[model samples]
Target: MLALERVSKTYPNGVEALARFSAAIKQGEIVAIIGGSGCGKSTLLRAIAGLDRASSGTVTLDDEAISSPHAKIGIIFQEPRLLPWLSVADNIGFGLADLPAAERRGKVARALERVGLADKADAWPRELSGGQAQRVAIARALVPQPEVLLLDEPFSALDAFTRRDLQDHLLDLWADTRPTLILVTHDVDEAVVLADRVLVMRPRPGRLFDQIEINLARPRDRNSPLFDSFKRNVLTSLDRSLDRNVPDRDATQGPGQAMWW
Candidate 1:
């Protein structure tokens, strides 16, 4: 299990990105964190991934302390970050730095197979489409079979159709490997469809607002009444967030405040 305890980040420019942020991700479970803009969501992901150090907190994987940089944990950021000069196979094997040539080749082949890119092994990053590049990024992260997979809005930049396809692909990958997955996203439907638990975060000093357990069955139906109900609840929570920010003007209120069942 990966745990974050009382984690806080304070930049030199006097920006408080995170404050007392605490959350834990268990083995074989997918957890999604959702929040508004500038809510420290990305900061939280970076801290857990060990890309950025927390000002005051402890990050632990199992019983071992993670105080410094480590590589067993893999992070996929918003951008693909693929190497322009390297082939798809070579890019995926970039993380296997210390392995021997023969072992690296085997691992690279397997990783490509996992992401369904075995046939495109010789393709360059520029030659592949956006979705393909992202898959390469995922393959790179999965090559080592990481203990924890940290994703920060991996689908945010893609178009709607591509986003849905990638989401399905990610679920399939997770089911096969069963890595502890933690995704940070802004879309509530994406959170509901992808995660076991949806963690709602509030902005301005970013604290946990709600932990809504997704009780819907697997292969969730986005158009069914059950899925509609789930979406309604999340929208309600989002509405509450916006209401809190608006001024107390009863005359200016709209009529669409009615709650859905």
Candidate 2:
């Protein structure tokens, strides 16, 4: 239910973050975007969420052009941007201020319970650990029952165990709510396991290089031969994209240069 048509974003310094990047995502689909460091993966998410305007073309939701922050969209950033002054419950209900007290409370309760943090309702933001804090952030986003969920490296900073736990939690949430999901990540294995489709991007004007569909069944087998094959293909595409700057060499390059694969 989302579409990007020739979308491009350029910074004030004239660096093109995106170049004619386009994609059409169906409702309830989970898509992952993987690419090199400087690619416009995060930039594309901002444009779709209407957190920033594109330099050219359009981002549309349900066929309507999105110009600014809209109710249909929800985003979770790398850091849990919780207000330390607010309690867990209050932070979740922050977006529901216009609703009646009872309705807001009910909404927050359901969201907290869904994220398995109902007990933390009264706890202050400072009292929660990193994973707990991120769960609260997810709860806050889901409280609005958004039509689309955008996660920009939401689990990147957490430890391996915590990240895996949250990934399963996220899938459960998505299965329950069925919101269109877009995840920007660097880990190929993570992308393969989590996405219905993985879009690999190239930098230096960041654009879509390949759209790899993961036809594997749910609860994907990370050690399966097919899974490894998909990961290899994604890595191969990434290696090809690295030639955008530093031509491919048979030997390793100096620091700050792209490593040849």
lDDT of candidate 2? 0.87
Candidate No. with top lDDT: 2
lDDT score for candidate 1 against the true structure:
0.81
| Candidate 1 residue-wise lDDT, 1-261, digit = tens | 888899888888888888888887788889988877777889888877878888888788886777665666888989999999999999999989789999999999987888888999999899998998999999899887888898999988898789889998998888877998899987776888888888877777766677777898888876788776666566656556544553333422343432211
TM-scores for all candidates: the values are: 0.90, 0.92
Off by over 4 Å in 1: 242-261
**Deviation in angstroms for 229 in model 2?**
1.7
Please give the TM-score that candidate 2 achieves against the real structure: 0.92
Number of clashing residue pairs, candidate 2:
0
Per-model clash counts, in order, read 0, 0
Clashing pairs in 2: none
Worst 10 residues of 1 by lDDT: 252-261
